[model samples]
Target: IISVGALAGMFTMMVTMIYSSSRLIYAIGRDGLLPRWFGHVKGHLPENALWTVVLIIAIMGGLVPLTQLVNLVNIGTLIAFALVSIGIIPLRRHQAFNNEGFKVPGYPVTPIISFLFCLLLMTQLSVETWIMSLIWFAFGLVIYFSYGIRHGHVAEKRIE
Candidate 1:
């Protein structure tokens, strides 16, 4: 029963991750950071983006080792968390949002501590993971500069 429950939980988490990732892709595509076809809705779903995500996951599952994939996911999540933690400092300084939301208790200190912990955890990952991450980052930078920068919503807003 315990094993069954664990499997069920893992399955649920995987589904949730796939859904959220597809939504992120859809949002980026809608904002012109990717091809607009991914933003198209079919029966109120971002069908193209959803399928694309599924396809990518399937390919990765088939081609990549499970441990490597897990490491990549861990490092990616850590980096995102670290960036968000550090970003809060600037956002708070700039007063980007109104004071309606829950405030951080220690302000800069809390976020800085969180970012440092994330960095420390990231450093524990394998060297291969770091190499893979750098390659992926480079690919993203290329795409952003070559296409996304010109076609994205921010650029459109600037043109107006």
Candidate 2:
């Protein structure tokens, strides 16, 4: 019963997440984040993004301890959610796209709930995991500031 539900949920979640994540990578690559090859869809999917994700998961699944991997995913996802909540305010005010689509309801409450939920999960992560996340974030910052800032389309538009 419970196990069946859990398995079903896991399958549903994985399929949806992979679909969404690959689409994001496809969009990003289309916007010139990675490479033109990544933007190309194969059989109605972002082939490069899907393959890259599969390769990464396979490597990590083989290498990482199951317990540590769960905690690591939790910490990473929580932090990303928290950042999304915080960053949305600025983006909403200075929107690049006009109100062509539906806007979020309960703006304040929504973001607050999202932030607190992320914070709670983040707090459950181990100190070592936090440290590792910090290191990864620092490296990401370096890459963003170096290559992304210099050559990013948004930055180019800003400069122009």
Candidate 3:
């Protein structure tokens, strides 16, 4: 029973990740970071992007070790959370949200502490994981600067 429950949970997580990643790839393709072929849709579904994501996921699963994959997910999650926490400062200053009723107890200090802790946690991860993440990020930067900056929808609109 426990094994079945764990398998079900893993399946759900995989499905959720696939859907989220496919949507992100679709949006990036739509914005011109990737070939428009990836953005092709059929009946409101990003089928091409979905296939791309699936292929990438399969490749990673086949090539990358399980431990490395776990570290990748952990590091990515921590980085995202830290960035979000740090972003709260600018967001509050800009009055991004209208939440006047309830408030965090520590305010600015809380987010700062959270960001610091995330950094500390990241230091515990393997250097290989960090290097792999950096390589992927650099690749993304290259794509964005090369294709996205020139052909993005926003850039096109700005020029018009």
Q: What is the C-alpha local distance difference test score of each model? A: 0.90, 0.76, 0.87
lDDT of 1 by residue, 15-115 (tens): 98799989999999999998898899999999999999999999999999989988988898899999999988877776546756768889889999999
Model 3 poorest ten-residue lDDT run: 151-160
**Model 1 lDDT at residue 89:** 89
For model 1 the TM-score comes to: 0.88
What candidate 2 gets wrong by more than 4 Å, as runs, is 93-103, 138-151, 155-160
Q: Which 10-residue window in model 1 sums to the lowest lDDT?
A: 151-160
Candidate order, TM-score descending: 1, 3, 2
User: Per-residue lDDT of 55-155 in model 3, one digit per residue for the tens?
Assistant: 98899999999899878878988998899889887766655457686465699899999999999999999999999999988998998888878877765
Write candidate 2's Cα lDDT for 44-147 as tens digits: 88999888777777787799787777777678778778998977766666656575575667876788788998898788788988887788689868866765
TM-scores for every candidate against the unseen true structure: 0.88, 0.76, 0.80
lDDT of 3 at 31: 74
Task: Identify the candidate with maximal lDDT.
Answer: 1
Tell me the lDDT of candidate 3. Answer: 0.87
Q: 2 or 3, which is superior by lDDT?
A: 3
